[model samples]
Target: MLLRAALAALRRVEPVIVLEQLGSTFFDTALQMVVRDRCANATDPGRSREDSQQKAMTDFFMTYNLILRLTPILPSLLLARLSDRGWRRAPVVSSLCGYLLSRLGLLLVVVFSLPLQLMLGAAALFGLSGGYSAFWSGVMTLVALRSSAGDRAKAMMRVELLYGLAGLVGSLVSGHLFQLYTASLGHGTILLIVGTLLNLLCLILAIVLLQVKHVSSEEPEEKSLLPPTSSNATAVEASVSTNLVNIVLLFVAAFLYDFAVGGAIGMLGPFTLKAPLSWSPTQVGYGNAAGCMIFLTSYIGVILFRRCISDEAMILIGMLSFASGIYLMAFATTTYIFYIARILNLFALIPLPTIRSLLSQQVQPSSCGTALTLLQLTLKFAGLAYIPAFTKLYQNTLDWFPGFIFLLSSIFTVLGMIPISILGWRSAGGKCHVRTQGGKQPRCHLEEVPAGTSQTGTET
Candidate 1:
């Protein structure tokens, strides 16, 4: 019984999420440190090395992240289609293959002392294998298929919580591992090797252990908002139109919010290594762990908030939290101020996963993977914008105001909130139920209450 239970449990994707995130976190710190080290060593004495190193770091990431974003679109769409067709493991397995190869490439680079430019090739390979777009879409599709719509947001947030926990654990130990070396091996070589090995394990599990859950064949019951007539055709038509509009708006909001986040995140890699907060490897790991803590806090927020309010309201609260915190981040010169900013942004990760859950609800089960992948692809396009635009903006503003990009982020976050607020209004027509059938989580939806009917509950 114990063996069977353990095997059955292997069908869950939690392990894959944990392992991949852990590996990715390790690779991330190692790559950042390696890039900084390379740029520092290559800087000439003629100019300010600090400025030169910063420029080199920014320029490298700009090109690297651009390739990362743009190359995965076509492949990701293809994989998502395969997933929707019942080959749900396509995206997960292929992306895991990409991850393994990329980590291996980095490992080889570190061991052989290869030029940093070679990493761009690895990034291309990773993208061509579907990258994060396909992977996340695949995971979300699997999780969403197994879950009821009422519990979708909470389910997805649980996956993210697992992801963050893995990242925190990996980041906490990554610094010590990076510092460990032997007579033959150098700094960070051990860390890269471990990261690559973890990816390999994830690839094996994605193929051999992961189970795909198929959703119901019955179509979603988009409740009728209009009163009963001879036929429900008008209600169906109105519902379709409404769904189309909501999907588009959700996409817009997600893009804007991602854009806001990308700006601050893009700069943070180089920002921490700058003047007032020149964090060491351990300190960097701790800082990253601090960021990961938000995932836990956000999940808690979802648990508490998803019960009383609509998902849109939760998203708004999250956006406001980020906007306010990132605005404070504009002047985070000291480490304590940075921690304070991070603290204020505790619910920051809530919006995107909740947005994804909303997107999943807008489409049929068969098209869930494609819809989620498109959302991921849309965010990639957002990343494409920030990679060049914010990188250049930050480079230009480095001397005058290093945190100018953060202010832009805050503004974009505020702009992102508009669509969600609109969504909230559109879905607030009548009373909502706190618990659906089987006592699942609340859904952020509404139906028309006729003139004579009395509504008792509040909008979810």
Candidate 2:
């Protein structure tokens, strides 16, 4: 009975997911405060110029991004490989430890007013702990293991919804929390402390309350060393290779889409903190909360449209929504216009989850961790390229047109949509068909519909 109870308790990792995201989001807002404060302090003494602060913040972010991207590649890859080898919780626990330390480091910074560059060390520590790449890759593997392929889409969407909801709650209260002790000696210290506590709690929960064992699928029968062995084995190898190629395509799509979104949002806070739409901290929190709400709206979109449309179509619609909204944001002169543009992004959250689901379906269970980690690696590398370019572009155009960064983001988003469009065209026109069965002689046929039958008569 005790064993059964333990197993049952271990099955519930959702709470851990929720708390982790909540803590991360809360710290995210606090880090924004840190950036603003540190930038003002780093410039000339008693200088509070917006341009100086902006430049300081940009420089800090660029450095932080570099550290985050460069440090995680090897650790995340190693941790993911370990996870696939049955140490399923290794990456998750290590990554949570990273979060704990990073948050704690930030909290200390807030309490002591340390140098802004210290956060770079913190970021490096976090990356060494496998950071977001390993953590999310582990989480995806867990989700995939627990779900059937047919239901994996909904399962992944459920996690994204939870993540968004936690972020929404965190963002809604973060700004207020940041102000609560500002008049006291602590200033934003209380908020960071709370975030640290939350991180510690999540790390504890992850260590004690979660249990997972990843058992890899049996290896294929050993083939002869010589080339061109059995025809059947050759066909199997070719099929596996093709599936991998398709998954790589999915990752590329995700990389481009994430680049567009990340670049736009990275500059958004600094942009809003400046003239024209000079937003207060509360407004910034609300703006972030609005972005979180996109996940909820996209979840609803998945529910309503997924039944009638394919995942690719849903992704296409989401890409278009982001492209349109971001393009309009280039002309958003007022906060109201900005909010309107955000509203137009209701479908913006669909593409990543849908693309992830599609990718998850293409690979075997054993490769889930590696596949997801590589996908994240792609995103990180994209960030490495896009963050500096976008920051420089925004800074250079700060006087005449800061919104040009959003325009560039919209263009990348459009570029992302093209791959999905090609995928959809291929899928719908019966050019690409993946066999669902196993074994070397798996049955295959051209996916088609009879001339006299309805569109859905034989194919989705």
Candidate 3:
């Protein structure tokens, strides 16, 4: 019941969250166009009034963009704490309330002044939507860890499938809406209406989730099957020498990988729109939808191969696939080639959840949230450091030396594959003993079951 309610609420709010994100992307594009027009006409002899208005709008959008980046980090920190405290449901409720109130406030502000409304509304939507990504990522990670090994891959696949479907539908619809109402209704106004409706639906879902009952700990059969070390005493010490080594290696690898990939993606859409391969907004949206489709299909394949192959092998395959995709993208000469490269790139990402799941199994459950959060923080920090530099390089050099920036990005991705290769080699050589399933005792190596032993199946 609790799960049903929670899912219902998620479904309700998800569309609004998606719409807001789409709107933010659209606003960024629109703001860029306005800025360009303003700069072009700044020298006009009789356009002083228009110049002033354009400058004001440009400043507003720039400020809004800055807030969009910063505001999400604060809420993410709060959500991290809530996750650590096991207040997952409470955070969901809070997010819903916050989104609704922000929307209502924006609506009133817009009523008083259209300009202020656009600025504030864009900022609020961006922050709310951006924060939702991390919030949902954390929630899904927890869910994956809590589930049985048999169900873990399937659950992750399901989440990916839903995310893809949302992206596909949302992007296509938003694009059509914008094209249809470009003259009649501003894109911002239409986005606001869509967002409001989605938030209301999400609120209803959140209310429903409050009534679902969690399983009782006192149930005799359940108690017998539960893992040992559920108490605070079992919290893994962060200072333990071996644990510290593993953690450091994991963190470094995550940082490098995310830094490269994040920087590349940060510039991807913008570069596509303004470069040798200038793609229209609809084309970009379609590309994104295609990537999601590829990701969803590859995710299913990952689940299917989970039992047939070792985790190390899977990771290696994913990395290789990713590296190949990056190289292909670096040399893409046409839209079709770009689409193919993106599909391959999506396939390469299939191992992310699997890798995270592996990391979770290495640590005690009590510290799972902290471990995951640390990894997330490291990746985000790396991305922040690298994105601007890469974006500048891509923007300045993409036209004259097409593919140069992409080539550099591809090199970074290849470098990231090194640590994963090392880890995979170590794992396949039987050195790492991280159990992929929940259990009372930490095993030193993979289990050796009788050839004929029957394995129990759990629901996905």
Candidate 4:
């Protein structure tokens, strides 16, 4: 029974998470080396090696960020719209193709010592296929379509848990993989090959095993996940106006929170390689592994706290935890202190997924693809702005203080808490439960309910 249950769960869950983790682990591990190689190759013969290398790295990153952000916006939007209109597998399969090609591009870069600028072309291809925006939106739609509102938070958390666990394993192994074949196949070719294979597997899985069903937003009364509640049923209903307001607020919060987190992740590798902590590749991999640990710990946190606290409260706590940890990271000059800061960020990933689950509850199932894709758009657009800004900031302060970038990240995280706080306060004050149901504005329920949990009591 346990084996069957596990198999059933795997069949229901999306495999994109594992594939993405494998590719990301390989890409991030190779990115720094690629930049360094490009810089070395570009330096004028007998020139100031340090200055030339630094400039090359900076230029490469700035250009990479710009292309990555700009190229995908339109394609991802188009792909997402088509998915919403019934072409569900297009985005998933196409994005996997992009990942495979991109990894292959990286492999060629390491194998033939191709120009670093070639990756920009690969990035363009990735964007053309819709990249992560379309892929994630599609995956989120799959998750939402498979579960009801009350179970969505759990479902999303489970996906995140799998994603993080895969990331942890990938990160832990990536350094060894890179090192093992560096002498035989150049620096990062082996890792890139592995990533490409992983992407291919995902593409195959999507083509063969994955099946997307269009679940109805309005379930039958007899089959409702929430049991009928005569007295408190109306309390959970929200007016359309109120729902609109809350959703807008949630998106704004998501934008701010992601800006901080994404900016930090984008710049951390180069920053660590320079100045106070000149970490080796192994150390870099370990640092990334530690970051992946956040997912596992955050998953555990959700399980432990969801029963006791509201999702809104959990999001608030997540934002604060990230802010504190990132703030401390700005002062971390040693390896030990850096790891300590990572430990402090155990709950950093909770807010985004929780916010997404909350947003899923506000929309009908048919709109999940559109809604989540728009959310992904907001985040990717935010990344477009933040990555360039953070890279520039890190470059300017590299000599005087490279850690300044982290300080700015910490500030944005603090700002992200505002909307969450407002929502939490409103919920605490008993103004959140009176919601809309079946075209009727019902009376507000006074009972405290978590953001995604049904106020009317759930099925056993």
Cα TM-score per model = 0.92, 0.87, 0.70, 0.87
Show model 3 residue runs off by greater than 4 Å: 1-70, 94-130, 182-184, 210-243, 429-460
Q: What's model 4's TM-score? A: 0.87
The lDDT for every candidate, in the order shown, is 0.85, 0.78, 0.53, 0.77
lDDT of 1 by residue, 1-460 (tens): 9999998887789999999999999999999899989998547455467877888899999999999999999999999989878799999999999999999888989899998898999999999999998899899989988887667788999999999999999989888888999999999999998898899888888899899765563433332223323265865676567767878889999999999998798888799898878888888888889889999999999999987887889999999999998999889999999999999899999999998888876666778889899999999999999889999999888777989999999999999999998887776653442335576777664333211112333422
Error of 1 at 330 (Å): 1.2
lDDT of 3 by residue, 42-161 (tens): 443443544333344334444544455555665666665666677655445555555566555554443343445354664566456434434454555455444554455555556556
lDDT of 1 at 386: 86
Q: Can you write out model 2's per-residue Cα lDDT over 31-120, one digit (the tens) per residue?
A: 887788767645544434777788888878888987888899999999989988888888889999999999988887877878767889
Candidate 2 TM-score, C-alpha based: 0.87
Question: Considering lDDT, which of the candidate structures 1 and 2 is the better prediction for this target?
Answer: 1
List the candidate numbers ranked by lDDT, top first. Answer: 1, 2, 4, 3
Please, what are the lDDT tens digits per residue for candidate 4 over residues 1-460? 9998765655554566787777788777887766765676557454356545665677688787778777878888888788878888778888888888888888888888787789999988988888888888788888877776667777788888888888888888887777766356876777778888888877877877677765554543222222234455443343444566678889999999999998887777766766568777778788889999999989988888787778887898888888889888888889999999999999988898888898877665557688888899899889888977887787677667777988999999989999988877654554344566898878666442434555443210
Candidate 4: segments with Cα more than 4 A from true spot: 1-10, 40-55, 182-184, 213-238, 429-453, 456-460
Give me the displacement of residue 121 in model 3, in angstroms: 8.7
Supply the TM-score for candidate 3.
Answer: 0.70
Off by over 4 Å in 1: 42-47, 215-232, 430-460
